[model samples]
Target: MPYPSSDTPAANPSPADSRAARLWEALPGLSYGADYNPEQWPEDIRRQDVELMKEAGVTVLSVGIFSWAWLEPSEGRYDFAWLDGVLDSLADAGIKVALATATAAPPAWLVLKHPEILPVAADGTTLGPGSRRHYSPSSSVYRRYAARMTRALADRYGDHPALALWHVDNELGCHISEYYGPEDAEAFRGWLRRRYGSIEALNDAWGTAFWSQRYGGFAEVQPPAPAPTTLNPTQQLDFQRFSSWALIDFYNMLAAVIHEVTPDVPTTTNLMASSATKSMDYFSWAKDLDVIANDHYLVAADTERHIELAFSADLTRGIADGKPWMLMEHSTSAVNWQPRNLPKLPGEMARNSLAHVARGSDAVMFFQWRQSRQGSEKFHSAMVPHDGTATRVWREVVELGAALKALAQVQGSRVESRTAIIFDYEAWWASELDSHPSQDVKYLTLLRAFHRELFLRGITADLVQPGADLSGYSLILVCTLYTVTDAAAANIAAAAERGATVLVSYFSGIVDQHDAVRLGGYPGAFRELLGINSEEFHPLPQHGTVGLDNGWKGRIWSENVRLAGAEAVVSFTGHPLAGVPALTRRVVGSGAAWYLATFPDDTSLAGLLDSLLAESGVAAPATAPAGVELTRRLGAGGASFLFVINHTGAEADVAASGRELVTGTQFSGVVQPGAVAVIVEDAPGGQPG
Candidate 1:
């Protein structure tokens, strides 16, 4: 039987897209859960866990994600007795299951039997069998064993009463992400052969002649390992691409087995930190998931972290194309891994969870339910903290659970944004190559800065891929897009032609997919769309600063920008290229294009964006102070909601006239400090009185 995961394969607007659709269609109302590890506790403790889960309003439990060792202690000797009892008990308590395939951590027996399956570091050190995810992604032997385990689990629990979703491996590229053994070398060679048909083509694309590092055959090429000197940029780029695909291929193999055995279950794996992770391209991986899921942890040390969290949530929602997703893992309080684990202040935990929902997450979940008594994550906070239900974390968890239950009306809703920020993994990979102009040119840092500007102004931006449907957005920002593919360039140009405001910042449109420059000039692919020409990249010294004619500072990067058919918008104040146009704008048909030749400071970037937004006739969500984030989600039949989040210590007024969903009071007042309020409006895009 064919499962109805999705009826259509278009890029967006699938009938069965959001997690809310699949989960709510099976079970009504919102989802609240955590990663359950019952095997860690005794049967008596597990009985207590069930009662607490009911009290906490947890409808779903992500079970068996790391239970492979317990399920099959010895090869071929199955033991589902304990799991069966756990599932049955949970079902009796009315809790559904997001059934994990349990392939994330293989048992010691398998790794000990085939040590060759262990991942080898780039330094030629083979990782030992002590930790989890030690298996090599490129090892065929590992795949064979993983597939066997997957088939067995799916066959046994295909029609289980508690099964709701299928989770494939935990955090695909956490550890063992990059492999450099003979197996990986062989795999890399094959990947290269597929990407570039002939050795001559490969050499030409890699520009191997620069360092006398030409390869005559594909077999001679090696996985870019720790070299005695600087490694080849193209080789490193391909290896990153190959490693990402290797993990994806592993997921596909497991998903095939689950589909064959339990076709009705939708498959997904948790994606972690899209801006931080380098190996996996989530935009590509999102297609495989019937419902996209992500694990987000805030930089609690930063005072403005809520803004970053909102950015991550918006990016994840954009990857799902406005579909509601799952917040698979987050901390109830302080996480243990950071340098300093600062517990969330009063009301901050609920604010963090609801921020995700306010953006577009349907399910609010965490890494673990109960805090561990022993392990590397013993200090990590949980739904039930170490102090039991009497603690502040517990009270907040219970409060968030009640809030989610009351949010049943908001289920299946989509958050819509007229602004988009283009984020490409390939561009991030290429821009950070070894021999770049400045080591300070971090891609995510700059992108996040631009995103924070829009966010501070109470505007939500979709973190879109280059090929995403730009027709839906009015303002598009492509910041530091150093690597430009032909298709990606055309997509932006087409968007500009269709009357969208386009902004291409410094260091953009410089290289192609092969890590090679687009020969004639800088920003070769996007010069025409931007209506400006650049000759070279002029990187500033470390901690260097320059002045912009608009009274804002420019720092870290500057380019020699000259006008072709566009008019100058901002010029350098005192530099060798003074009055040579720091920024330019061009009117293309009904749309307009603007180019910034240097990385502007935050104040400058904000002013530039303000001008652009005004010129494009786009309005912010209503005038509010900084640290107050705003977003709007729409339900079927004209139901609209306004979400106001105040991330600061000072109270701020949220201008709205409607019924507040969480408190059931009439809206329009000063939102409390470190608080969140959801108001249901009478019409979409309704302004405050």
Candidate 2:
């Protein structure tokens, strides 16, 4: 039931734990297939389709993803007769059901029956509801129906062997949180009481005196009205926190119902990437989930950069502490949501799938299985296409399935490497929320500067959680951590003391968890680690960055940095803020801490990071070169799966001595444009020989 639609809860992992044991048993040869619906097809077609799935070795079926209408045809009169039959059919075929809540969208019957479930928009316009995820997350009536519907389904089929996993209310966080509805206001008041205990505490934390946001009572507090320009920072941040917690509560309620009824079966909700429209505190829910799986879909070949997508994949892995996770939904050839839906050519799909495995994905699966006969996701790609498995996409899916089955134990295997990238969510939330020198200066921009260099150098950098232990890795990178938390700062300090080389960027540690400014200079919480006292940071436009004390020309927005114990490794040529130390290095026990004052463009960032990593004795993949991306996974064979991805527009030479997993033929030259090869080797082979 779990792996591939992955398993094993984070925060606790041991073979002795019953749930952990079940999850572990389920993970080996764990298979994933998207929601399958042949309900609309003829009997003969349905008959053959069932046989195909078994032949393909598909073990998990995400059933009834969009079957709201079929399950509840009338108000209070559920009709699971069809779904019962579908489950029976799949059970006969040895497939496990990741049951859907069927309330992603209420049936037209429910909407027509109770139109009050419709939600209002932020601009104060009532949206005429006839869509999925239309009810405000805080709507009482919607909650009643959702809970009732889920409980009924669970009670009905909880004991069924085919009923393996419960997917409660798909992608629970959608669009954004409620802002205008009456239900939202009520929920916000309740949440305030729970969070701050009373209006007085809330007032103190929000610093309500500045703009008279102080409330007389919990009931008196309402979601603040955004100004014609922008909402006040205190109010805005509270709202963001409120909204994220609001969705999490909804998911918790749904998961609770399932756990109460069928504790044996695993339960999970699909998580979206950080770029998601809704921001839920996943770190808070990581332990609550059966498995922390996400739908990661960022991809690029020759048209865009690979570093962005690669970082995304790494974050998904880090979400569950490198405990194997799933790629819940993917497009076979091309995706529907992007600005340009570019079909993956030749080896791209296989390459990307292996890359996820290289990162930490247990299984890869598509969004919708049947290629939706109706609805918005009808165009979404799947393993078995709309036209059936005759297409090139189907062949690729079959090939991938075969490969995964052959490599049965690879799903839950851990990847071993000497490089790691540190991402702090507080840092991410803090930097952007800080009312500072530049709102445009973001955590992502600095991360790109740091990771781009690693990608260019062919290093499989682990995207690690902020508080993760870094004693194993040779280097730990902290880039533009704007909101450095006390716990995270301690981890970095400890890592530095443990002899790890850390790279920190400007805008690091400027604020606290509440998005409040840290008082002592800039980078308040983390000032001591880098041994630099930063004063005012001037936001530099493109031209403001120029030559530094080092040979490389500093690019991107430059910050005016001040120093104390740490000296400038890279400095300005000859200008105000020039000799102020653009880059500084400090000794923290046995480790070294390097801080960058600004985000540098690709050329400069790569140059500086490469120099630092080389000096630290970190190793790079042998086949990697400029524009040739490399990812590796260490396996039981003492073999490392080295993935070579060429992001350039032209072919590049790549030399490998051992076997190439993608191609049977041997290679010892440049890798072509978009060429992906998984070469198995021993111990990274001493860095490209």
Candidate 3:
């Protein structure tokens, strides 16, 4: 079949399709609040909770994330004691509900009573009690009870006035483990059967005979584990594929439970941005979801440099296949997990959220509504506080909420993008897991180097997946794609061949989905797509820096790249690898592809990326002087907005092409410390937002 399938667009979905769509229609006037645990609160406090939310303009509340203990008080007995009251109070407060599936954890009583619910890690170690998300996805007992609980919630609250959305199993990878026990092995056999149909076809595709992975029928197959590297790349790739599919199956079963009860309500699970390691194939769950939401967390605060966020949003977008999105979980303030939990100084939260909207976001809610007392996230910041309000974070949240309300019309609008970046977890995993060269060169890092530049320069970048159409985009970057199906590779090549500028990173196109190395040199399979053959590689240590051999040189890790249907635009200097191609560009069809062999500093990367954006006609924030930052988002009804923020401790010069929304002034230069400029326009070059 042709790539991306040119899918038949759905007929206007029925009202019975989901109440979730009703909520989307109501999105502009809505407000998003975070995890509310009325299960742990008293009636009076719960009442106060409603008032507090209303004060902050919170129109929707995600209830029951950790309410399994309250709901399933016993194995077969169910109690709606606290939950019923919570809903009644929410109804009184005029709050809509995105009811959680409440299956993230089974109560301790259930876990001890039924040890079968306990999960085993890939290494055969059993996860114990005391923490949530430790339950096994494939454990039959767990699924049965989880389904029962979902059905109960649906049957009871499906028609509730407060019902708006369905949140399934909060933060799906919080447990940090994947199952590979005998249970997984059993499921893998079944999954393999469905994927390849027959053992002969599977063997033919995997070339199993060479690796002794040959199976007579299906009984011989087992789930992939962290085992002998000597195993054939095909088996290894299959194991990874199996692992990804297993998680999807696990989620599917949970979702089935939700559908069984509340078929009219949309269901979705929140995935994290940095979890390529788990092989969560969200593509498999796209249509199954009412909305694709993700927790945007990164170790570094380089909002522009973190292409992972764009990748997350893009992948999330495609999962729903161009449907609007939700930033279901993100930090409105400093995150405790990073090495430096720097608070989002001033307008950063507003800026980052707008960036999501610029690409395509329906709402920008955070992970936490209130700070925790004690736990792994004890220090995580929240929009509200344990101290009963009056905190900087809470104050900022209030202000940000007001801003969102002001721009309500922009909420569900998607950017009609001309640029895209394909984010493949499979390719990321394959590049990282390879036995060859080096693990230091992370595929994601390579991708971010290009994306960060576009982000800071105020260019909209869409993150997409393999086989997605590139006709809508003028530029597409595919980084470190070590392994992919021929179908996917073909789509990318087709896009580049059709006048889209492509950036092909090192170590890409080296193998297939089965981990089989392509004939010829590196990026062997995509040589034609990229139009190059790497003759030699000049690998460098992390500290070994190089300057471009050109008149301009800077400190960066560089390598020599050979050119074919491309030009040696940049090369390394000062080291033995100096005077060789570090960067090359090739015109494919009517467009082009630029290849980078090794990692480089952000500064150098910015130059290359910015130059590309300029060539593509995407404009940067006009007057964002030093210490002042800018961004823009495409909104509904042909409206767009540019965000100009001051990041300096002192006042700085700001640029603007139109009137600012915050102050309604045509900004030129000189913005005060921590000040902001929100420009609203009509289209690409419309008014200031």
Candidate 4:
């Protein structure tokens, strides 16, 4: 089968889909590669690397990521001889290149000459150089230097035969993400001035009058710096937003340089572990990129690793608007940074890579091509381990590469879902701020609870922002949305009017984007749509539980809700808020809105979601056992590819029969532990037996 071309036009979708379709139309086949730093190895070793690249079926390599010092040994001095050789060698081996600007890390000489470029912490301590990503995003000196270097590199290699993509400044906002230096303070103040005309308006928006934190002028307004006591939460939240934008501006600078030099070359910066960090708002950053790329590492501490991986991948795909994205970096096995550093069980790595591909990743890549004997990530697994091709990691690397070849037909496909969960960065930052009614009122906790239940049912939901177009979805979940805007509320209302069932959880719509309480009772903007009014919040003690009349227990939070036009689906039992609605549903125009005033346990949440799914006429594609994840990708040519991944330690079965593309066998029954089954659709799934 021929791979989809970069010029294939897609059918009509929403406006967002059209923008995403343009991106998808520029990407052709699945890119299988790794980040190769041939600068680390000797001449002979570099030559041998090409053979290993071919052996592992590597098609692309991201070179010169951290080679800033090597590329420019001294001020105004150039040394592209090594990189020129590496690029030429890779081209000779039929491997493409995602060339880096090599400006992510400045050399020691530059850092020493311009020490003001180093980042500072909230406590006003300047971070010394030695580590990567230490430059302040707002530093003028750093920006000038980085931009000049980026321009030179782009101009030199813009038309290189091996150049396939341009990777702008590696992993923006990873380490030293938020800077609080003098330069950053000035930049933050400028950002605030542009946002609010004067200090008085800023004071009012920050609600600084209550704590006597009112700013006398723009100079008085500083980022939420460390103090003896608790800093103002709203100020800190705004600073976080400013810091993210500053870093984004840093990325945009390099991107501008690259675009001016090489307009046709697509550019992207790897967004790292968004599920774990809320430093950067990816939704805003996604708009700036020609292609969206992400680096996802498993949270070793989480017991349900697969679920978290799926959530992150699905979220990344959603950020791409179901367009093909690049899995820029992932470990082949054990990552060195985690405390435990547990090696993945056999076949686990393959399963994890395929999970990303199943979601929407057109490219599957790892961090490093060869293991490092030095540096901070020496122990991190690589495609070619220190033991070379004689190791298990190498074997699995070859196997996964071959599997990707066989699954090339899945390229340019998109995952379609009738369900979507609102994952907002502003809400996450606002809800996690100090001084919430309950300390446990988290954004991801509630989101994952609902998402895990849907995952178990073999249902895939698109993770979207609160204000995204929901007309394409049948069921939409807004969980722990403490901060909401009028436009977002209107979008939800419109979706409900269009016959979509919108389910909202506790602590939603309680505050605006400014972090001010939405007066006129709780759930300010959504009161009319949800058909419920909340009076007061009853935050339970830690590890507390409240029994409900529907044989379910509520945890973490419960609210005093009075029904307006909605009917109570679940009421509190034997509590102070007895007979008051814990969960209520109301019909709004053509659709329905259900509000849960308290957090429900797994069983209760699952039961509630099942009812919501049934009411919306949404069902799983097939009946699969627990620990088995099933998702489908639809190609532009009307081909459907189903991925079944069994993440358990034992065998599990799915009720669908197809030709298992991975093993080239007819699979009808069971899949072994840590196994993945890629099935090209021959018959409709979930058909009546």
Candidate 5:
């Protein structure tokens, strides 16, 4: 469903139709726990896990995620004795269960029987069953067996008291997002026939006239396989869309069975909604889910990874339409995937968990409850490490759980933001295609840079879809939105014309949804709103930088911009486009529009953002020292909660009046180094006084 417009407020959930609300009502406080894998351990260890969960205030556990093989060792055979004991034990311990369908990994027996279910790479190599997620997304045989398994689980456990939610296949499309096998080709053709309705429409949409690539019929089309040279950009883009749709279709298939069996139980799949996981367009999939859940792991190489964490959490909240989401999976410490795999610093785990909660995550969970003794992820951090409960990780986990319980009132609250940044997964797929102005022009890079500036200044911004309601926002930032629909472009322009401060970065509005150029000049769709036109692009060398008249440096990109009605705010100094405007502003009806033609240095971008925020009348919740991250959440009856996270070594003072929930005392507006605080403000309104 399209998001609610400014005039239409999002509907509040009721007991009759909202399984998410039902699940939360069943739980005691804010949900806390991890993915519990009892199949990997013995009965004694499983009993010990129940005790530890109670001690740590764990309200829920995701079980049977990768237990398909254990549940069904052979074809048409079943073994539910062990799972029955596990679920009964969890229920006795008062822990809710997000029971999985256990279809993430097909059993070895099924794969051995049907080798055609395996996924094939673009290079025609078959991915075997040695790893997880090895099945082709479009395989009917795989879907048949998966649906059977889902039905069996739902039939047995649908009415179980411990079942709070139904977890769909684990992290759909985490690996093998695209397949090139015969089955995939057939499915692709069927999807195309349904989408375009005719072969001629497909040819026109893909612009196949170039290079004699026009398709005579849907049967002749295939996945964008490797060729002698670069494949058609539109074909590749369509394949990306098809791949995501295939996974969504698979998920919907299983969700249908669950809904039929248990109409009141919520169903969700963990989505990787971070910068690192970009294959899936989560916004398109959000409406199908009963609750939104996301998995995010920090990049070990980045020094300021916490900012990236905030970005991911905020993006997840945006996908949920400002509703509270679930932190489905995040490592407690170091992860084994990155090259270095450095362990997190002391107190970083608590800070990370609270940051997500501050950004609208109602539940806090980890990838696994106990560290594995042997596996690819054996070295990955978990709640219980190899050294046992005496470790710092365990202590912090218990402490974070108590903190969440104290802040239980924040569960249904919503994060407050008046500024929005347009984010589109299709645009991300198209912007970084084989041919572009610069390879350094990454969609996430520009997004992170802009978001980091706002983070540093203690401002909150929602990462919204291109077609989302823009009238509710005071400021809108469109960064590297290379491909957009004509309706979306008109919506953004209309927002600017109605008193919103709009900023358009370089390379946006250059193409349509079909990957075809908009025609005429650069940024064709936004020319009238921006009041500027660019004739040509001037991407700088890999290491080159150009001087700007504002005493800043521009890197990677510059354009020969011509002013139609906008006033020049900054210009290039000594390049081929010297004296041409690098930044320009124009007054649209009651508002203003700004255009940036090049990438600016951090200082320069920060200054420009400051001016934009001021002009938009958007300000931080409170003035605080550097390294203090502040966020606010609003609840019913004018209740407000302020989250203050101090990442610096020195003490920081934020101007606020409230009762701190963590320490259960009156807040003095002073936070200690490396500490986190959640305060219930005394003020009636959600905003700071």
Candidate 6:
């Protein structure tokens, strides 16, 4: 099979694609609004919502997200009177609608009738339908009902003047990503037959010969459910793949109906694309979505949560192939899901929303419009808090709306970066499997740390897929990619050979796509390109650290690395494997390949990245204080927008001159503390300095 590349033309559509073009034509400006659940409110309150939405400068709203029961009170019965009124009211108020198919949750009647549609956990616990996303991804009965609901929606609203896009379903793979029910087992076998083609091929790929797990036929295989002991790692990996594909397959089934009914209208589904969401390989799903949209919420526990938001936004932009994407949901204040949902401080909401815009998002929206009076998400913050429009959240929502309106020209712009970070969802799933050399080797640990360092340095990096075209990137960072296809490995090596600086971290390139070890040595795929090989891993205990010859501390991992044809940049100072190279650099043509055999502390990692940046000539967009974040988005005719976010307590000075979109004033490069600015550069050439 060919390695998946994000650069594949068919997978990533251009900004001028008809779907994106139609979306822009419908919304006309930077979109602002939330998930509007008028079904939960009375007609009087629904009328009040339009008035408030107009005042807030909301241009769009996602309607009928959880309205399955409301749409159809009983099986084979339908009602669209309430939804008709809602859409008409929004249209009268000049707000567009991303009308949902209303199949996120099955109604009580449908689920009660076909209980097998519910998802079963790995331990055989069936999840009921009280919560959203309760249906199994592979349930044929569920898909049939969902398709019918979708057709009903598209048929009714296909020609509605207010319809902008067809929201296929709510956040997919959110609560119930995997299922182990009878339906899922049958679906998994069918998917395996399609993927492997033959039982012999399946056995070969799974390496089932080990532990007597080989199968006589595809029927003998099953989901990696509860077992007597440790289950097969390959089986677990394949199940993850199958679960993700099943959801996409389900999405396609609904999308096809929408296309058939309303071929002109674009269709999309909100994806949980942040670091917290790992169940779906969104890169694979991006091809199916007419426009990429994602939901992100700040982790209340993380002090630097905004950095994580930037990372997520950047990754989403990468999934969109550098095109503008939509931020379907975020929060105006505190979210109900976290253990301790902390309310946003004054101006924090604007900063959060604009941070996403600064990265690549063309629209900024939230999870809900009005605060729920009663439900599981009653406490979840919204555009209108329980205190009505008199609260801080409401004021911020209005202010954010006005700000987005002022920055309307920033839409359709693209964030450009010469540095690329290789991010693979399958690799993330495979590397974090059980029984690894170290449990501390988390998939996102290194990527997040490195992205934070880059953010602090004001250097924007694109999260590219493994098999993507790498020749354009001046610097490529491959961190802990334990599983990779041979084609992807060759692509990275080719990038380095073509004078692109490449960095490969520890435990990478150890296994093939099938989770089988490469025959030669550790980091087997890139050993020749990296000019190094390791015989074994030396993972440290919890909270343990190792010293390096360069005075850096290595934690969580160390390796018995031996330089094959490269020079050691840093070596282990002492231990059972004393004087071993901790870091090595190999000169390949005009470029260099650097290898880190262990994880370094933050300060050391920053220093090493600084060195790499200097060597590769990748500099920050502008000079600013440590806490200020800078990113640039380029548009047509050599136009650029500079986004400066100051997270520090003290005001900072940056070397930039432009008309600030946030304040509508000429910026002299001075930014106030805890504020955000999007500056439109005055110069004709918008290249970053």
Please, what is the whole-model Cα lDDT of each candidate in the order they appear?
A: 0.83, 0.69, 0.69, 0.85, 0.90, 0.89
- Write model 5 residue lDDT over 318-346, tens digit each, in one string: 89988878998999999998989999999
Residue 448 error for model 2, in Å? 2.6
lDDT of 2 by residue, 1-689 (tens): 01112232445543223553465465456466666765566667666767877766677777776677777777778788777877888888887777877767777877777777777776777766566777777887888888888888889999887776677777766664555688887888888788889778878777778666677888877786655554456666677678777877887787778778877767777887543323565666566677766776654333443466676677776667666677776667766767777777776676677666667777767765656677666766777778888888878777777766655545555655566777765456545664567766766766755666676677767667677766687788887777657898888888888888888777777766666678879767778888888777777664556677666676555666778788788886666675778888998888888888766666777777777787578866575458877765654434456667776778877655555555555555567776666566534535321
Write down the lDDT that model 4 would get. 0.85
Best first by TM-score, ranked: 5, 6, 1, 4, 2, 3
Superposed on all Cα atoms, model 2 deviates from the true structure by an RMSD in Å of 4.1
Q: Which pairs of residues collide in candidate 1? A: 509-523
Candidate 5 similarity to native, TM-score: 0.97
- Candidate 1: minimum summed lDDT over ten consecutive residues — where? 1-10
Model 3 TM-score, all chains together: 0.88
lDDT of 1 by residue, 485-591 (tens): 89999999888888889988887888888878887776788888877778877778899998887798888888888788899988987868778788899998779
- The superposed Cα distance between candidate 3 and the true structure at residue 139, in angstroms, equals 1.5
Candidate 4 residue spans exceeding 4 A from truth = 1-27, 664-670, 683-689
TM-scores for candidates 1 onward, in order: 0.96, 0.90, 0.88, 0.95, 0.97, 0.97
Give per-residue CA lDDT, model 6, range 342-367, as digits (tens).
Answer: 99888899999999998888899997
The per-residue C-alpha lDDT of model 5 at residue 594 equals: 97
Off by over 4 Å in 6: 1-16, 684-689
Q: lDDT for model 2, on a 0 to 1 scale?
A: 0.69
Please provide, for model 3 over 462-507, each residue's C-alpha lDDT reduced to its tens digit, 9 standing for 90 to 100.
Answer: 6677787677777788877788789998888888778778887777
Summed backbone clashes in each candidate are 1, 13, 14, 0, 0, 0
Candidate 3 wrongly placed segments (more than 4 Å)? 1-20, 204-213, 226-231, 275-278, 298-322, 332-359, 374-378, 535-538, 545-548, 551-567, 570-582, 601-603, 626-629, 650-659, 662-672, 682-689
